[model samples]
Target: MVLKCSPIQLAHSVLLTLGIIWLTPVWAAQEIRVGAAHFPPYTVRPERGADTGLLSKLLNALNQLQSDYRFVLVPSSIPRRVRDFERGRVDMMMFENPAWGWQELSYTAVDMGLEDAEVFVARQNPDRAQRYFDDLSGKRLALFSGYHYAFAGFNSAPKFLTNTFSATLTYSHESNLLMVLRGRADIALMTRSNLIDIQRYDPKVKSQIMVSERVDQVYRHYALLRLDAPIKSQEFAQMLNNLRDSGQLRAIFGPYQIDVVAM
Candidate 1:
């Protein structure tokens, strides 16, 4: 039995079919909540309405590349991320280091094969040279609160940092840098990628500061996944590898001086 349909009916049927096909993935895709902290260059403006950072970009790329999962950002602070992860508020945390207080947690650590270092910054002066960064004694340090420092034996306690290193803890990297320029602080510790972004935005500020040749620590990035995460660490690593092979990672992080090592 062959029934001929009108042009309008045929068009309607085609449209309905297309809509169902498009909606299938969205319905079936698992939600993967990624923790986004106020980590600059990696995650900037996280508290703002819309996040603009490498993590956001990477998630966008991941979404576009696959339909099996839907990646979303769950805002968390540096100090609260660990709690959030344990509470299942977020399934994954990217740009993390295992040594940064994640050692005791039972989770899978996926090597991101990316690297960025922490460097010292100080105001430029005739008397100040690379040698100025060689010593930490008698120096007032400005650092981000809730960040573990290798110099302090990975201690992130505000009281410990203040008493042991004479540190001024703050949330703003810009403020830390300004403290150095204003001579309120002798040195400010910040990520190399962050410094690059700052210098790129404010070229004039670049000349006013001296970056240290000695790095305080090299940040070997990782993705820490909960044991019950929607996806396994191996799967996440493969997605990152795909991004690396397609040059997406390089395009996103290369300008910021974040190294994307081959997996």
Candidate 2:
């Protein structure tokens, strides 16, 4: 026996099949959880809502570039991020350095080919010159909590910073800068990228604050991947290279004064 379907019925069948194909991907996109810490100009976690920064922009661009992997931001703190990565809470960490307490962990480090530096910010005064920054012995330091500074021997202990350096630990870089501007603190250590951002938005900051030529640390950024991560370091590095070639990375990080070196 032979059967023939009507044109309307055949069209309906085709439409249904097309809908199924549209709804399903060729393969499930592997989920890659990236740690999102509150690093200004790199990543910012507001009092509420999702995080945003250069990291966010880079992730968004990576997502649009490929469908095999879905990169999602997982909230983590400066002190807790290493632990989170160790515990499998996050599979990847971007804009990190190996010397920043990661020596003990076994992970592949992919050099991000980016560079930034930490500099001192102080209120401008007629008498204060570059010499004022030469000695921090009696200076009141305003520092970000959980951040390691070369000046402090890379120790991020709050009590150590407070007692040894007479430092006040806070979470906001802006607050630290303001501390200097208001004479609440003698000096504030800020990232060059962040200071540039602040000066861009508030031009008065450039005139009111004197930035030291001395650097606390020069950040050579890297992306650390867990040993068992879905994506390998080579693969991730290639992805970054793709972004660099396509100019996406420059578009995202250039404005912040971050160097986009070829991989």
Candidate 3:
């Protein structure tokens, strides 16, 4: 049958098809994969069906805002993680302070909304060995392998001794704390909030541990994003800033005793 169709009929059919396409659930599903390390009290491994700490809370909030994103724990090594993200093996990853000097690596600084402070934790034993950086010269000092110092240049003093003192480096803050508790390592450097969280989980260790000294006060943590991420870094930063201003950020972290550092 040969029949003439009106222009309006063709236009209406096209609009209906377009509307159906736009209404599909797949159109709203934006897949953004994130990588993280197992840093206790912030991010931890799910053991025996346990929830990973504060990071879990943060992820929950993120999920509320986003529908199609998931975070996976990457090993605590910055170099390897960066390589993965750069090569498009992973979509995004969070970092405290990345050493990547490349302009292509876009990052959104979260400001952590917490105070920047470092503490030197050691065992409480006067006879064994009091607090002495010199004593730590030949021994090993442990820090989280993948973490970076936000205020690296602020502390001008050399971390290691030159000639008479040489120390080995160990990774993993949790392991480092264990070493200190067991008297394996002379001292372990950690953040104050992290120490508090650890103590909460293991109260017996609190009696044996002591915060020797405040190393630095401006060691704020930040969330570094990849430049090629589907979400804009600057926009994320603004959203975080707005979250802080609205008091929602503080509320989210306050229960966990994490203070928010205003941007």
Instruction: Flag clash pairs in model 2.
Output: none
Alpha-carbon deviation at 150 in model 2, angstroms: 0.7
Query: Considering every candidate listed, which one attains the maximal lDDT?
Result: 1
Better of 1 and 2 by lDDT: 1
**lDDT value for candidate 2?**
0.91
How close to the true structure is residue 67 of candidate 3, measured as C-alpha lDDT?
53
Q: Which TM-score value belongs to model 2?
A: 0.90
Better of 1 and 3 by TM-score: 1
Residue 44 lDDT in model 1? 86
User: lDDT by residue for model 3 over 1-263, one digit each (tens)?
Assistant: 88876999989989999999888876455566665555566656533335566656665666565455544444333336666666766555653543433235655544555544566777787664334632455565555543443333322223422122232234456778888888777677786667877787888888887675546444555666665667766655666676678777787666555668766
Candidates in order have lDDT scores of: 0.92, 0.91, 0.59
RMSD of each: 4.6, 3.3, 5.9
| Model 2 residue 7 CA deviation in Å | 16
Candidate 1 wrongly placed segments (more than 4 Å): 1-27
Error of 2 at 31 (Å): 1.2
Model 3 lDDT at residue 233: 64
